[model samples]
Target: MHRGRLFRPTVFIIISCILFLQGLSAAPPLQTGSFIRDAEIEATLHEYITPLFRVAKLDPKSLNLYVIVNPEINASASIRYSIFINTGLLLESKTPEQVIGVLAHETGHIAGGHISRTEGAMGKATLAAMAAMALGTAAAIASNSSDAAMASILGGMSMAQGIVFHYSRGQEGTADSSGVHYLDDLKWSSRGLLEFMQMLEKQEYLSPDQQDVYMRTHPFSRDRVDFLKQHLKNSPYANNRLPQDFYEKYDRMIAKLSAYLEPPGKTLLTYRATDQSVKARYARAIAFYRENNFPEASKQLDGLIHEFPRDPYFHEIKGQFMFEQGRLDDALTSYKQAIEIKPDAPLIHLAYAQTLIEKNQPKMDKEAIHELRNVLKDEEENSFAWRLLAIAYGRGGNLGMSSLALAEEALANDKPKIALTQSKRSQYHLKSGPDKLRAADIQSLAERLVKEKE
Candidate 1:
């Protein structure tokens, strides 16, 4: 299968090397992956929304956008002229109009100049107090990751409260009105935004975790919803409606994402479910899975697979689970089935490649080098692949080729992965020849070259 293991490890190796490899990264080190890929979504939003901002007298360039991956429902604009979005928010939003509305509101924060003024206000009045608190914050700097995050969050909240001037709820009100106006000017529908707000307002009654985070942070009150309704009443922009083509694209994107991210038995939640009851089940299944309810996850996966046996994605997820359980043969079979069903997905290739490397050492050593060579043919600057290929070469008894690759990795990233790949060469000066004689010869050569230059 496309994403399954290339081979099952012998029983002994499974107990030894497989366990050792998994142990190599027990505590997921700080995953500092690039946030650039999601920028495509931001760029698309910008292209469609910039004109609206222009008409509203906001500089599109000055507004810095940050897309963060936090599962929690939250958005903030205290320090940077930025919009930090959660992927969950994007997935859950019912429409593009609502997404644009949220952006408009954040833009309102920047245009309103909230965070800067607040900080400046504090600095002016209590330079001493702020300094003391800043120092106190240093106490939180003691090397615990959780403590540091809390300290930073507390620090930001503290400075925000005393020093920064927040645009009052009235300001939020004015922005809401202006934001809709901009949306209306752009001839985008306000229904989506209103619908989203109503959803949040209703959600306020539900458990905070069950509802979108917007309600909790945005400070929902009956007044805010009522006020929006009042403004939207007799409004020209209220008719901003989604086109049929837009729905088709939106549905397609949601389907692709659901197929990609959902585990087995997940009833696809693509802005709609087959039924409200089924949708609730889907959401609950996801919560259970996310909360580490593996039995529940398995149960849910089984249920969904039973319901939709024809769906290849479900089997793909089953393969993932089996792979995790060390059922290499089963995973391989499932992944192969998935590959037959969906051959074009790049992620499938990545998964298959990873599994292949994990299972068959001899095949992996040969295939990895071959793949890297082919990849280097197109893009020679791929230092990471080069490093891997170097290791493969070392495994193949090509020491010189391995060293050359190691040098490239070190030069490109300044951090060779580990000593396992002749890591000592990068670290210490080495020679099989007598070190004393080599040192003296190098010293003599240097002296002669230096004297000639002089």
Candidate 2:
């Protein structure tokens, strides 16, 4: 949905409140860190987790999977069936199976309702700690000994840990058992889980602070590794190997991530011409694009498309490159080819819509609006698409719809004040129908946020 940028790295944390419990004034904010919305990576991950979701009796479509641009080896499930995986974990994993195993563990947390239950427990402890800290600080001000005052503050903080640590450990154990079951049901080996834990076992030698973020969050133990090993011994698919295509997709995912995240020189050096593997060539092509060597980039991509004619991702990347180079007609052709190959890819549709808008022909504006609306039907949270929809509506002279789109875009981008303004503007132009009602609702929410700030 993002326009004019291949990789839009968000600068701020996205805070969303999902209210689960009844009669609560406020719920804890689910902080989804900066996300990368690469079409190929997202499509590959969706394929990988679909079977796990089915095994766990959970609906995959209801879950929002976010890839955090963190280098930490960690993943977590939040209360709203949201799974967050670090890019570092994906990059560091030696194989797709390792990443899948981690995903299984996180899915276990969601299926078991551990995130909500743990949040309830943690919430109580956090409130108690906050109260204690206030009381402790007051006592410290009244006390003469500074050392004794500091001890009092630390004691209050440790009390919160006491309330949550044991419960967290139990949840970890449950998730581990459930994850193994999910893997077993899907006829996949549990060895990957054990191997990941074995890596964690080495972290045991380090102090808690020195351990990897995964160890700190997931709380790995020798007993958990032993459990996985025992399960693998009895599993029918203990020695099963994943399909070669899965490995190729994994390689492509890693190559794309590295080419985008690392320096161009580093990518080129790592993926040398001597290594003519598809992934290596793909990475080198991206590196060339980053260095603005358009001819080399296009030549490499054209070769790839010739070899893998039906690969929608290659076409998507080609479209992106052409768009960046201001070759509008060529970009449109590539985007249409990608959409034809992968009709269900929302990101491709979004990219095509962006290209249509850029073309700026009167007829293309309507088509752009149609494409943007199609994407929003499946991806309502995409702020970039909403923004583009606003622009398209404006170009078509539908000021009411344009203002409404802007309002929604502002809300999605966490700008409540702008949303309020746009909503009011929309109400002035829109008829007294569902659209006006929706505008009123947005106005109310934005007003609430403004009042809270005041």
lDDT of 1 by residue, 268-353 (tens): 44323444333343444443444456586577666866786765555565565665556767776766666677654323333344
Q: Model 2, stretches more than 4 Å misplaced? A: 1-33, 116-167, 452-454
- Best prediction by lDDT: 2
RMSD in angstroms, all models? 14.9, 13.0
The worst-scoring run of ten residues by lDDT in candidate 1 lies at 12-21
lDDT of 2 by residue, 1-454 (tens): 2222112112221222111110011111111233456778888898888899999999888777767556667777764466778778888888888988888888888898886435556556433323222211122224534344334433433343332222276788899899989988888877777788888889888998888677776777778888888888888999987767889999999998878766778999999989989999899888888787878888888999999999999999988787766687999999999999999988789888878887778799899999988887777656667777887888888899899988886666456799899999999999999889989988988887677547
Q: What is the lDDT of candidate 2?
A: 0.72
Give Cα-based local distance difference scores for all models.
Answer: 0.47, 0.72
- Flag clash pairs in model 1: 1-335, 1-336, 2-335, 118-163, 118-164, 118-165, 122-163, 189-240, 264-301, 265-301
TM-score against truth, every candidate: 0.42, 0.81
Clashes of 2: 0
